[model samples]
Target: MLEHLDRMEAHLRELLEKEGGWLPFERFMHEALYAPGLGYYTAGSRKLATPTDSAGSSDFITAPELSPWFGATLSTPVADVLRDTNSLDVLEVGAGTGALAASLLPALAELGLPVNYYILEVSADLRERQQQTLAAWEPQVRWLDRLPERFRGCVLGNELLDAMPVRLFCWSQELEVLERGVVWHDHGWTWHDVPADSALSRIVRERMPPLPGYLSEVNLQAEGWMHGLGDWLEAGAALLIDYGFPQHEYYHPQRHRGTLMCHFRHQASDDPLKLVGLQDITAHIDFTAMADAAHASGLEVLGYTSQAAFLLDAGLLEHLQSLRESDAHAYVLQLNSVQKLIQESEMGELFKVLAVGREAAVPRGFRRDRLHSL
Candidate 1:
């Protein structure tokens, strides 16, 4: 692991030299997480696992891994989209460990809707793990290296947008904006602020207030992704689930430090330079911005709500009752996972679900949606 990290650092250093000793933070983060064979996700590492399975070996656990019910319940909305759009396919982006696919395929099959399942994954290591976990659904589940020219299906992205690279900016009372970049000095990587470029400056000025020393992130890449979705999604809906806030709450005056975070071995920190390519770096999403991007790209905002609300509307309690009647032992175990997924103190309130579609009906999961909030 040490040798691998060294090589990753060397690769970053070469990039810094090529960029004239200053590398934009967005580019640095992109390479740190996705660089050919050295970045955190690109390299060999045990990244996703449930707490019981991890034993302190993994960086973090996701909703799908925490409870199979997560995916099982999600199948409700997926089925709604499939029927509404008159399609028989599902596309998942950045499938971590294939846990969701494992559960979703069976659940969808139970609904008498056995359709083709596709996964778009960038990490070769994760693809291998997914293949092992989803072996039972072979030939039904296909992996893609990139987006298809035209797709007509329900798109799912769990905890996906946060991982995209973001542009970090600090605004001062004097109305000056500075962009954060990475630089090597004293044999270590550190932050170096430069005057914000015209594009970045315009974005910050338009989206944020000029407060004294307010730091925040802007996800231009995620906006571009929304545009890309508009290009190929001829007839279907895209469900995006992640932790985030609406624009007003996201850029609130009290949120001065921003939501940039780093995860390593199940521990959270604000330092990204410390781990180079070893830890996962992420930022909370601005849902309003995302909705705006989707609208600009000619997509309709179908729904927006908390994960808890969406899950409940999608029949979580009904699924729990069925499990209780079928197997007592499994029910007892899954009940605990259910609590963690829905309790407000856990992922329930913090995480949100946003649905954008074109020529598709609003999913039943959003029957109680809080789109007014966005």
Candidate 2:
């Protein structure tokens, strides 16, 4: 582990020197998380697990890891898209541990709709782990290194947009915009502010409030990803689940400090400079920006809602009742997990679901959606 860290640090130092001792935060973040063999996601590390799993073995746990019902309930909306489009294909981006695919495929089959599942994963290490976990469905599943030129299926991405690189910016007392980047100083990485370029400054001035000393991030990469969706997503829906808020709430006056976070061994921190490539670094998504990008790309914003509302509207209670009749013990266990998933104080409210597609029906999970809020 120490040797790997040394190599990763050296690689980062080389990147800094190449950029004249300063690197844009987005560039640094991209390399820190996706650099060919030295980045966090590119390295061979156990990244996902349930909280009950052996401590310190994984960096963090996602909603699918907390309960199989997450994927089971999600199958309803996915099936809707498949039936509406008359397609038998499902594409999942960043399929961690293949847990969602494993749980979702069986549920979809139970609903009398078996589809081809494709995973577009960039991490070679994660692809190997997903293959091992999904071996049982070998014939039905395939992996791809990049997005296809054209596709007709339901696209799913859980916690995907948040991991994309974001440019950090701050406002000065005079309301001047500045780009916050990284610099090598004192034999370590540190923060350095520079006059925001014309493009970045224009974006900040238009989207962000004129509050002095406010710090936040803008995810142009994620927006670009959304814009590209229309080119390949010929006739289907893309369901993105992540933690974020609308533009108004995202750049609200009170949210002075940005939504940047890091995780290691299930512990959360605000520091991304520490641990180099050994920890996970992420920021919150801007759903409104995503919706705007979808519109610009000629795709419709089908729906938007909290995870809790989406789950309930999609028949979570019915599934729970069925489980209760079959096994009382398992029912009790899952009830606890459901509370964590839907409660206002937990993942339920923080996490949101956004659906964008071309010629796709509004998913059943968005019956009570809050699209107007966006």
Model 2 TM = 0.98
Q: For candidate 1, give the lDDT.
A: 0.92
Model 1 lDDT tens row, 1-374: 78887898899999999999999999999998999888889887888876477476998889999999999999999999999888989999999899999989999999999789999998999999999999999989999999988999899999889989999999866879999999999989999989999999998888877887899999999989988899899999999999999998999999999999999989999998988788999999999999999989899999999999999999999998998999989999888889988899999999999999999989977877888988
Query: Where does candidate 2 stray beyond 4 Å?
Result: none
Per-residue accuracy of model 2 over 43-102 as CA lDDT, tens digit each:
887888864789989998888888999999999999999988999999999988888898
| Per-model TM values vs. the true structure | 0.98, 0.98
Off by over 4 Å in 1: none
lDDT of each: 0.92, 0.91
What is model 1's C-alpha RMSD? 1.0
Q: What is the lDDT of residue 327 in candidate 1?
A: 94
